[model samples]
Target chain A: MPTCVGVGSPPVMAQPNNYMKPVGSDTRFGAVTRVRGRIDGDGNLVVEGAVEGNISLRGDLQLAVGSEVTADIEAQDVDIEGTLDGDVSASGQVHLGPGSRVRGALRASAIIIDDGARFAGRLECDFDMPAELEERRR
Target chain B: MASTVIGVGITIEGEITTEEDVVVHGTLRGKLETKEHVSVEQGAVVEADVTSNTLMLAGTLTGNVASGERVDLQSSAKLVGNVRTARITIADGAQFKGNVEMDV
Candidate 1:
Protein backbone atom coordinates (compact mmCIF):
# COMPACT_ATOMS: atom_id res chain seq x y z
CA MET A 1 0.00 0.00 0.00
CA PRO A 2 1.09 3.56 -0.61
CA THR A 3 1.64 5.91 2.30
CA CYS A 4 -0.54 8.94 2.65
CA VAL A 5 0.92 12.38 3.04
CA GLY A 6 -0.57 15.70 4.00
CA VAL A 7 -2.68 17.63 1.55
CA GLY A 8 -0.03 20.31 1.20
CA SER A 9 2.96 18.10 1.47
CA PRO A 10 6.00 19.51 -0.27
CA PRO A 11 7.05 17.89 -3.52
CA VAL A 12 10.44 16.35 -4.13
CA MET A 13 12.87 18.52 -6.03
CA ALA A 14 14.10 17.01 -9.28
CA GLN A 15 17.33 17.54 -11.19
CA PRO A 16 18.12 20.91 -12.70
CA ASN A 17 17.48 19.78 -16.24
CA ASN A 18 14.09 18.04 -16.19
CA TYR A 19 11.24 20.55 -15.94
CA MET A 20 9.75 22.08 -19.09
CA LYS A 21 9.00 20.38 -22.34
CA PRO A 22 9.33 21.84 -25.80
CA VAL A 23 6.31 23.65 -27.20
CA GLY A 24 4.62 20.94 -29.23
CA SER A 25 1.80 23.23 -30.38
CA ASP A 26 1.76 26.47 -32.33
CA THR A 27 0.25 29.93 -31.72
CA ARG A 28 -0.82 33.12 -33.65
CA PHE A 29 0.64 35.59 -31.17
CA GLY A 30 3.74 35.65 -33.36
CA ALA A 31 5.74 33.58 -35.83
CA VAL A 32 8.70 33.42 -33.49
CA THR A 33 7.15 30.40 -31.80
CA ARG A 34 5.78 30.65 -28.28
CA VAL A 35 3.96 28.56 -25.67
CA ARG A 36 0.58 29.77 -24.48
CA GLY A 37 -1.16 28.00 -21.62
CA ARG A 38 -0.91 26.87 -18.02
CA ILE A 39 1.96 24.47 -17.38
CA ASP A 40 1.82 22.02 -14.49
CA GLY A 41 4.49 19.38 -14.20
CA ASP A 42 6.92 17.56 -11.90
CA GLY A 43 10.08 18.03 -13.93
CA ASN A 44 12.39 20.84 -14.90
CA LEU A 45 11.42 23.41 -17.55
CA VAL A 46 14.25 24.53 -19.72
CA VAL A 47 12.88 27.11 -22.11
CA GLU A 48 15.38 27.55 -24.86
CA GLY A 49 12.60 28.87 -27.05
CA ALA A 50 9.76 31.23 -26.19
CA VAL A 51 6.51 31.11 -24.26
CA GLU A 52 3.52 33.42 -24.63
CA GLY A 53 1.50 32.23 -21.67
CA ASN A 54 1.60 31.62 -17.96
CA ILE A 55 3.71 28.78 -16.56
CA SER A 56 2.53 27.06 -13.42
CA LEU A 57 4.61 24.17 -12.23
CA ARG A 58 5.17 21.97 -9.23
CA GLY A 59 8.91 22.07 -9.84
CA ASP A 60 11.60 24.40 -11.01
CA LEU A 61 11.47 26.80 -14.02
CA GLN A 62 14.62 27.74 -15.88
CA LEU A 63 14.78 30.15 -18.80
CA ALA A 64 17.94 29.56 -20.75
CA VAL A 65 19.90 32.38 -22.30
CA GLY A 66 18.59 33.85 -25.53
CA SER A 67 15.19 32.49 -24.62
CA GLU A 68 12.25 34.85 -24.16
CA VAL A 69 8.96 34.57 -22.33
CA THR A 70 6.03 36.99 -22.56
CA ALA A 71 3.86 35.60 -19.78
CA ASP A 72 3.58 35.05 -16.07
CA ILE A 73 5.31 32.11 -14.37
CA GLU A 74 4.39 30.27 -11.18
CA ALA A 75 6.32 27.44 -9.62
CA GLN A 76 8.00 26.07 -6.54
CA ASP A 77 11.11 28.04 -7.43
CA VAL A 78 12.36 30.25 -10.27
CA ASP A 79 15.75 30.62 -11.90
CA ILE A 80 15.91 33.27 -14.60
CA GLU A 81 18.92 33.48 -16.88
CA GLY A 82 17.29 34.70 -20.02
CA THR A 83 14.79 37.38 -21.06
CA LEU A 84 11.36 37.64 -19.49
CA ASP A 85 8.66 40.19 -20.27
CA GLY A 86 6.08 39.51 -17.59
CA ASP A 87 5.47 38.82 -13.92
CA VAL A 88 6.78 35.98 -11.75
CA SER A 89 5.43 34.41 -8.58
CA ALA A 90 6.86 31.56 -6.53
CA SER A 91 6.23 29.94 -3.17
CA GLY A 92 9.92 29.26 -2.65
CA GLN A 93 12.61 31.55 -4.00
CA VAL A 94 13.69 33.55 -7.08
CA HIS A 95 17.16 33.78 -8.52
CA LEU A 96 18.59 36.22 -11.06
CA GLY A 97 22.01 35.81 -12.59
CA PRO A 98 24.41 38.09 -14.40
CA GLY A 99 23.65 39.20 -17.96
CA SER A 100 20.03 38.32 -17.28
CA ARG A 101 17.36 40.88 -18.13
CA VAL A 102 13.78 41.09 -16.92
CA ARG A 103 10.89 43.55 -17.22
CA GLY A 104 8.02 42.95 -14.83
CA ALA A 105 7.06 42.38 -11.21
CA LEU A 106 7.96 39.60 -8.78
CA ARG A 107 6.38 38.07 -5.66
CA ALA A 108 7.81 35.34 -3.45
CA SER A 109 9.23 34.52 -0.05
CA ALA A 110 12.94 34.67 -0.80
CA ILE A 111 14.83 36.45 -3.55
CA ILE A 112 18.42 36.37 -4.83
CA ILE A 113 20.09 38.33 -7.60
CA ASP A 114 23.65 38.42 -8.82
CA ASP A 115 25.68 41.40 -9.96
CA GLY A 116 25.37 42.74 -13.52
CA ALA A 117 21.82 41.45 -13.71
CA ARG A 118 19.28 43.94 -15.06
CA PHE A 119 15.74 44.00 -13.74
CA ALA A 120 12.82 46.45 -13.54
CA GLY A 121 9.72 45.61 -11.50
CA ARG A 122 8.01 45.54 -8.11
CA LEU A 123 8.64 43.10 -5.28
CA GLU A 124 6.43 41.43 -2.65
CA CYS A 125 7.61 39.21 0.20
CA ASP A 126 5.72 36.79 2.45
CA PHE A 127 7.57 34.87 5.16
CA ASP A 128 5.86 32.38 7.45
CA MET A 129 7.16 31.84 10.95
CA PRO A 130 4.97 29.49 12.93
CA ALA A 131 7.80 28.03 14.92
CA GLU A 132 9.34 31.40 15.53
CA LEU A 133 6.16 32.59 17.12
CA GLU A 134 6.28 29.74 19.56
CA GLU A 135 9.94 30.27 20.31
CA ARG A 136 9.43 33.93 21.14
CA ARG A 137 7.28 32.91 24.08
CA ARG A 138 10.08 30.88 25.51
CA MET B 1 11.31 16.10 -13.29
CA ALA B 2 9.53 19.41 -13.24
CA SER B 3 12.61 21.40 -12.36
CA THR B 4 13.54 24.19 -14.76
CA VAL B 5 17.02 25.55 -15.32
CA ILE B 6 17.47 29.14 -16.47
CA GLY B 7 20.88 29.05 -17.99
CA VAL B 8 23.31 31.93 -18.02
CA GLY B 9 22.63 35.06 -20.12
CA ILE B 10 18.89 34.36 -19.90
CA THR B 11 16.28 36.83 -18.65
CA ILE B 12 12.64 36.47 -17.62
CA GLU B 13 9.90 38.82 -16.47
CA GLY B 14 6.71 37.41 -14.95
CA GLU B 15 5.41 35.09 -12.28
CA ILE B 16 6.95 31.67 -11.48
CA THR B 17 5.52 29.19 -9.01
CA THR B 18 6.48 25.56 -8.54
CA GLU B 19 6.41 22.64 -6.12
CA GLU B 20 10.01 21.54 -6.53
CA ASP B 21 13.44 23.15 -6.44
CA VAL B 22 14.68 25.93 -8.73
CA VAL B 23 18.06 27.36 -9.57
CA VAL B 24 18.84 30.65 -11.31
CA HIS B 25 22.01 31.81 -12.99
CA GLY B 26 20.50 34.71 -14.85
CA THR B 27 18.04 37.56 -14.33
CA LEU B 28 14.35 37.46 -13.38
CA ARG B 29 11.61 39.78 -12.23
CA GLY B 30 8.30 38.86 -10.68
CA LYS B 31 7.08 36.36 -8.09
CA LEU B 32 8.52 32.93 -7.25
CA GLU B 33 6.85 30.45 -4.95
CA THR B 34 7.80 26.86 -4.24
CA LYS B 35 7.49 24.04 -1.76
CA GLU B 36 11.10 22.90 -2.09
CA HIS B 37 14.37 24.77 -2.27
CA VAL B 38 15.30 27.81 -4.37
CA SER B 39 18.92 28.42 -5.22
CA VAL B 40 20.13 31.67 -6.69
CA GLU B 41 23.63 30.95 -7.83
CA GLN B 42 26.37 33.54 -8.13
CA GLY B 43 26.05 36.04 -10.97
CA ALA B 44 22.28 35.80 -10.77
CA VAL B 45 19.92 38.71 -10.19
CA VAL B 46 16.32 38.43 -9.02
CA GLU B 47 13.66 40.86 -7.82
CA ALA B 48 10.61 39.19 -6.28
CA ASP B 49 9.11 37.49 -3.28
CA VAL B 50 10.47 33.98 -2.89
CA THR B 51 8.70 31.40 -0.79
CA SER B 52 9.85 27.86 -0.26
CA ASN B 53 10.94 25.20 2.18
CA THR B 54 14.54 26.42 2.01
CA LEU B 55 16.31 29.25 0.19
CA MET B 56 19.98 29.62 -0.66
CA LEU B 57 21.23 32.86 -2.13
CA ALA B 58 24.60 33.28 -3.73
CA GLY B 59 23.57 36.11 -5.94
CA THR B 60 21.56 39.34 -5.59
CA LEU B 61 17.95 39.39 -4.36
CA THR B 62 15.74 42.36 -3.68
CA GLY B 63 12.38 41.66 -2.11
CA ASN B 64 10.84 39.48 0.57
CA VAL B 65 11.33 35.84 1.49
CA ALA B 66 9.02 33.37 3.24
CA SER B 67 10.97 30.21 3.89
CA GLY B 68 9.64 27.29 5.85
CA GLU B 69 13.03 25.88 6.76
CA ARG B 70 15.76 28.49 6.48
CA VAL B 71 17.31 31.19 4.31
CA ASP B 72 21.02 31.22 3.65
CA LEU B 73 22.78 34.24 2.24
CA GLN B 74 26.15 33.29 0.85
CA SER B 75 29.21 35.48 0.76
CA SER B 76 28.39 36.67 -2.71
CA ALA B 77 24.74 37.24 -1.89
CA LYS B 78 22.93 40.55 -1.56
CA LEU B 79 19.36 40.99 -0.43
CA VAL B 80 17.06 43.80 0.65
CA GLY B 81 13.69 43.08 2.23
CA ASN B 82 11.75 41.58 5.10
CA VAL B 83 12.74 37.93 5.53
CA ARG B 84 10.57 35.58 7.57
CA THR B 85 11.60 31.99 8.16
CA ALA B 86 12.47 29.37 10.69
CA ARG B 87 16.17 30.18 10.41
CA ILE B 88 18.43 32.67 8.58
CA THR B 89 22.12 32.78 7.87
CA ILE B 90 24.02 35.75 6.52
CA ALA B 91 27.55 35.24 5.33
CA ASP B 92 30.37 37.63 6.15
CA GLY B 93 30.34 39.26 2.75
CA ALA B 94 26.61 38.99 2.24
CA GLN B 95 24.70 42.25 2.07
CA PHE B 96 21.19 42.40 3.48
CA LYS B 97 18.92 45.04 4.96
CA GLY B 98 15.40 44.60 6.29
CA ASN B 99 13.34 43.00 9.02
CA VAL B 100 14.44 39.47 9.88
CA GLU B 101 12.27 37.24 12.04
CA MET B 102 13.78 33.94 13.05
CA ASP B 103 12.36 31.03 14.98
CA VAL B 104 14.05 32.38 18.07
Candidate 2:
Protein backbone atom coordinates (compact mmCIF):
# COMPACT_ATOMS: atom_id res chain seq x y z
CA MET A 1 0.00 0.00 0.00
CA PRO A 2 1.38 3.38 -1.01
CA THR A 3 1.61 5.88 1.88
CA CYS A 4 -0.18 9.19 1.30
CA VAL A 5 1.50 12.49 2.29
CA GLY A 6 -0.07 14.38 5.19
CA VAL A 7 -2.03 17.47 4.19
CA GLY A 8 -2.30 19.03 7.68
CA SER A 9 0.86 21.12 7.39
CA PRO A 10 0.43 24.91 7.69
CA PRO A 11 0.40 26.80 4.43
CA VAL A 12 3.16 29.29 3.68
CA MET A 13 2.26 32.87 4.63
CA ALA A 14 2.33 35.20 1.68
CA GLN A 15 3.73 38.71 2.04
CA PRO A 16 1.03 41.19 2.79
CA ASN A 17 0.55 43.69 0.02
CA ASN A 18 0.28 47.29 1.00
CA TYR A 19 -1.18 49.52 -1.68
CA MET A 20 -2.09 52.45 0.46
CA LYS A 21 -0.15 55.58 -0.35
CA PRO A 22 0.73 58.27 2.10
CA VAL A 23 -1.28 61.43 2.11
CA GLY A 24 0.30 64.46 0.53
CA SER A 25 0.64 67.77 2.31
CA ASP A 26 0.13 71.09 0.64
CA THR A 27 1.06 74.54 1.97
CA ARG A 28 0.44 77.61 -0.15
CA PHE A 29 0.30 81.31 0.62
CA GLY A 30 -0.47 84.57 -1.22
CA ALA A 31 -0.40 88.26 -0.45
CA VAL A 32 -2.67 91.16 -1.35
CA THR A 33 -2.06 94.90 -1.36
CA ARG A 34 -4.05 97.19 0.85
CA VAL A 35 -5.12 99.65 -1.77
CA ARG A 36 -8.21 100.72 -3.68
CA GLY A 37 -8.22 98.23 -6.50
CA ARG A 38 -9.04 94.65 -7.38
CA ILE A 39 -7.16 91.91 -5.56
CA ASP A 40 -6.95 88.59 -7.36
CA GLY A 41 -4.81 85.50 -6.89
CA ASP A 42 -4.65 81.78 -7.62
CA GLY A 43 -3.19 80.61 -4.33
CA ASN A 44 -4.11 80.90 -0.67
CA LEU A 45 -4.44 84.43 0.69
CA VAL A 46 -4.07 85.99 4.10
CA VAL A 47 -5.30 89.52 4.64
CA GLU A 48 -3.58 91.18 7.54
CA GLY A 49 -4.03 94.74 6.32
CA ALA A 50 -6.82 96.79 4.82
CA VAL A 51 -8.46 96.21 1.45
CA GLU A 52 -10.72 98.85 -0.05
CA GLY A 53 -11.86 97.09 -3.17
CA ASN A 54 -12.84 93.77 -4.64
CA ILE A 55 -10.94 90.64 -3.67
CA SER A 56 -10.95 87.55 -5.87
CA LEU A 57 -8.91 84.47 -5.22
CA ARG A 58 -8.83 80.97 -6.62
CA GLY A 59 -7.95 79.49 -3.27
CA ASP A 60 -8.85 80.03 0.35
CA LEU A 61 -9.05 83.58 1.77
CA GLN A 62 -8.40 84.25 5.40
CA LEU A 63 -9.03 87.50 7.18
CA ALA A 64 -6.73 87.83 10.15
CA VAL A 65 -7.75 89.50 13.36
CA GLY A 66 -7.72 93.28 13.34
CA SER A 67 -7.82 93.22 9.58
CA GLU A 68 -10.50 95.08 7.70
CA VAL A 69 -11.84 94.70 4.17
CA THR A 70 -14.15 97.16 2.47
CA ALA A 71 -15.10 95.36 -0.69
CA ASP A 72 -16.71 92.28 -2.08
CA ILE A 73 -14.77 89.02 -1.68
CA GLU A 74 -14.80 86.09 -4.06
CA ALA A 75 -13.04 82.82 -3.37
CA GLN A 76 -13.36 79.11 -3.19
CA ASP A 77 -13.29 79.28 0.60
CA VAL A 78 -13.50 82.18 3.04
CA ASP A 79 -12.68 82.38 6.71
CA ILE A 80 -13.30 85.63 8.45
CA GLU A 81 -11.51 86.28 11.70
CA GLY A 82 -11.65 90.04 11.59
CA THR A 83 -14.08 92.54 10.09
CA LEU A 84 -15.62 92.76 6.64
CA ASP A 85 -17.65 95.67 5.33
CA GLY A 86 -18.76 94.38 1.97
CA ASP A 87 -20.53 91.61 0.16
CA VAL A 88 -19.09 88.10 0.25
CA SER A 89 -19.52 85.49 -2.47
CA ALA A 90 -18.03 82.04 -2.52
CA SER A 91 -18.47 78.93 -4.55
CA GLY A 92 -17.64 76.95 -1.48
CA GLN A 93 -18.38 77.57 2.18
CA VAL A 94 -18.14 80.66 4.38
CA HIS A 95 -17.04 80.38 7.96
CA LEU A 96 -17.59 82.88 10.73
CA GLY A 97 -15.31 82.46 13.72
CA PRO A 98 -15.87 83.63 17.25
CA GLY A 99 -15.26 87.32 17.89
CA SER A 100 -15.49 87.92 14.18
CA ARG A 101 -17.63 90.73 12.82
CA VAL A 102 -19.23 91.08 9.41
CA ARG A 103 -21.46 93.87 8.13
CA GLY A 104 -22.63 92.87 4.71
CA ALA A 105 -24.62 90.39 2.70
CA LEU A 106 -23.37 86.89 1.89
CA ARG A 107 -24.00 84.38 -0.90
CA ALA A 108 -22.75 80.85 -0.74
CA SER A 109 -23.85 77.25 -0.73
CA ALA A 110 -22.43 76.53 2.71
CA ILE A 111 -21.88 78.63 5.81
CA ILE A 112 -20.84 78.36 9.46
CA ILE A 113 -21.28 80.69 12.42
CA ASP A 114 -19.33 80.20 15.62
CA ASP A 115 -20.32 81.44 19.02
CA GLY A 116 -19.61 85.05 19.86
CA ALA A 117 -19.53 85.97 16.20
CA ARG A 118 -21.39 89.07 15.09
CA PHE A 119 -23.07 89.32 11.71
CA ALA A 120 -25.78 91.56 10.30
CA GLY A 121 -27.05 91.40 6.76
CA ARG A 122 -29.37 89.66 4.31
CA LEU A 123 -29.01 86.00 3.31
CA GLU A 124 -29.89 84.08 0.14
CA CYS A 125 -29.49 80.36 -0.34
CA ASP A 126 -29.79 77.88 -3.19
CA PHE A 127 -28.58 80.50 -5.57
CA ASP A 128 -27.60 77.83 -8.01
CA MET A 129 -31.20 76.77 -8.32
CA PRO A 130 -32.74 79.96 -9.51
CA ALA A 131 -35.35 78.04 -11.39
CA GLU A 132 -36.72 76.69 -8.15
CA LEU A 133 -37.47 80.15 -6.95
CA GLU A 134 -39.29 80.89 -10.13
CA GLU A 135 -41.26 77.70 -9.87
CA ARG A 136 -42.46 78.66 -6.44
CA ARG A 137 -43.85 81.86 -7.83
CA ARG A 138 -46.08 79.95 -10.21
CA MET B 1 -2.30 74.94 1.03
CA ALA B 2 -4.37 77.92 0.05
CA SER B 3 -7.00 77.69 2.70
CA THR B 4 -9.10 80.39 4.30
CA VAL B 5 -10.17 80.25 7.90
CA ILE B 6 -12.53 82.60 9.67
CA GLY B 7 -11.42 82.75 13.22
CA VAL B 8 -13.67 83.31 16.20
CA GLY B 9 -14.82 86.81 17.24
CA ILE B 10 -14.61 87.99 13.67
CA THR B 11 -17.81 89.22 12.07
CA ILE B 12 -18.70 90.36 8.59
CA GLU B 13 -21.85 91.37 6.75
CA GLY B 14 -21.52 91.85 3.03
CA GLU B 15 -21.10 90.10 -0.28
CA ILE B 16 -18.11 87.77 -0.70
CA THR B 17 -16.79 86.29 -3.92
CA THR B 18 -13.96 83.78 -4.10
CA GLU B 19 -12.51 80.91 -6.06
CA GLU B 20 -10.67 79.16 -3.31
CA ASP B 21 -11.46 76.95 -0.34
CA VAL B 22 -12.96 78.41 2.83
CA VAL B 23 -13.72 77.46 6.42
CA VAL B 24 -15.82 79.42 8.85
CA HIS B 25 -15.83 79.07 12.60
CA GLY B 26 -17.39 82.43 13.20
CA THR B 27 -20.50 84.33 12.10
CA LEU B 28 -21.33 85.83 8.71
CA ARG B 29 -24.29 87.17 6.80
CA GLY B 30 -24.47 88.11 3.19
CA LYS B 31 -23.77 86.61 -0.21
CA LEU B 32 -20.92 84.13 -0.81
CA GLU B 33 -19.60 82.79 -4.10
CA THR B 34 -16.75 80.42 -4.82
CA LYS B 35 -15.45 77.93 -7.34
CA GLU B 36 -14.00 75.41 -4.97
CA HIS B 37 -15.20 74.12 -1.63
CA VAL B 38 -16.74 75.69 1.47
CA SER B 39 -17.02 74.23 4.97
CA VAL B 40 -19.19 75.55 7.75
CA GLU B 41 -18.35 74.29 11.20
CA GLN B 42 -20.62 74.03 14.19
CA GLY B 43 -21.55 77.17 16.10
CA ALA B 44 -21.38 79.04 12.83
CA VAL B 45 -24.50 80.67 11.43
CA VAL B 46 -24.88 81.91 7.89
CA GLU B 47 -27.73 83.45 5.97
CA ALA B 48 -26.72 83.71 2.38
CA ASP B 49 -26.58 82.07 -1.02
CA VAL B 50 -23.59 79.73 -1.25
CA THR B 51 -22.07 78.45 -4.47
CA SER B 52 -19.09 76.20 -4.95
CA ASN B 53 -17.63 73.06 -6.43
CA THR B 54 -18.30 71.28 -3.16
CA LEU B 55 -19.94 72.27 0.12
CA MET B 56 -20.03 70.82 3.62
CA LEU B 57 -22.43 72.14 6.21
CA ALA B 58 -21.85 71.57 9.90
CA GLY B 59 -23.60 74.64 11.20
CA THR B 60 -26.78 76.64 10.70
CA LEU B 61 -27.61 77.89 7.20
CA THR B 62 -30.70 79.61 5.91
CA GLY B 63 -30.13 79.85 2.23
CA ASN B 64 -29.64 77.96 -1.01
CA VAL B 65 -26.66 76.10 -2.42
CA ALA B 66 -25.34 75.58 -5.93
CA SER B 67 -22.64 72.98 -5.81
CA GLY B 68 -21.05 71.75 -8.98
CA GLU B 69 -19.78 68.63 -7.35
CA ARG B 70 -21.56 67.62 -4.17
CA VAL B 71 -23.18 68.94 -1.01
CA ASP B 72 -22.74 67.27 2.35
CA LEU B 73 -24.91 68.00 5.37
CA GLN B 74 -23.29 66.82 8.56
CA SER B 75 -25.04 65.54 11.65
CA SER B 76 -24.77 68.90 13.35
CA ALA B 77 -25.97 70.85 10.37
CA LYS B 78 -29.25 72.70 10.09
CA LEU B 79 -30.12 73.97 6.65
CA VAL B 80 -33.35 75.17 5.06
CA GLY B 81 -33.47 75.78 1.33
CA ASN B 82 -32.95 74.29 -2.07
CA VAL B 83 -29.70 72.53 -3.02
CA ARG B 84 -28.51 72.00 -6.57
CA THR B 85 -25.49 69.84 -7.35
CA ALA B 86 -24.26 66.64 -8.83
CA ARG B 87 -24.62 64.76 -5.57
CA ILE B 88 -26.09 65.36 -2.14
CA THR B 89 -25.67 63.59 1.20
CA ILE B 90 -27.49 64.43 4.39
CA ALA B 91 -26.13 62.76 7.48
CA ASP B 92 -28.30 61.45 10.29
CA GLY B 93 -29.62 64.03 12.72
CA ALA B 94 -28.95 66.75 10.17
CA GLN B 95 -31.86 69.08 9.56
CA PHE B 96 -32.61 69.83 5.91
CA LYS B 97 -35.71 70.39 3.83
CA GLY B 98 -36.54 71.91 0.49
CA ASN B 99 -35.76 70.94 -3.08
CA VAL B 100 -32.76 68.95 -4.24
CA GLU B 101 -31.62 68.50 -7.84
CA MET B 102 -28.77 66.32 -8.97
CA ASP B 103 -26.93 66.59 -12.23
CA VAL B 104 -27.87 63.82 -14.62
Residue A60 lDDT, candidate 1, scale 0-100: 69
lDDT of candidate 2 over B1-104, digit per residue (tens): 46655544334455556657767665557766777788888887878788889999999988889999999999999999899999889999999978998757
Clashes of 2: 98
Per-residue CA lDDT of candidate 2, range A35-126, in tens?
A: 34555544445686566777776666778777777889888777788899998888766777786899998877666776777899966445
In model 1 chain A, the worst 10-residue window by lDDT is: A24-33
lDDT of 1 by residue, A41-111 (tens): 44445675567777766656777677788878887677777789999898777777676799998887766
Error of 1 at A127 (Å): 56
Residue B12 shift from truth in candidate 1, angstroms: 0.8
Total clashing pairs for each candidate:
100, 98
Q: Give candidate 2 misplaced runs (Cα > 4 Å).
A: A1-50, A53-138
Off by over 4 Å in 1: A1-138
Mind sharing the TM-score for model 1? 0.47
Displacement of residue A37 (Cα, Å) in model 2 is 15
Please tell me the TM-score of chain B in candidate 2 relative to the true structure's chain B.
Answer: 0.94
Question: What TM-score against the true fold does each predicted structure earn?
Answer: 0.47, 0.48
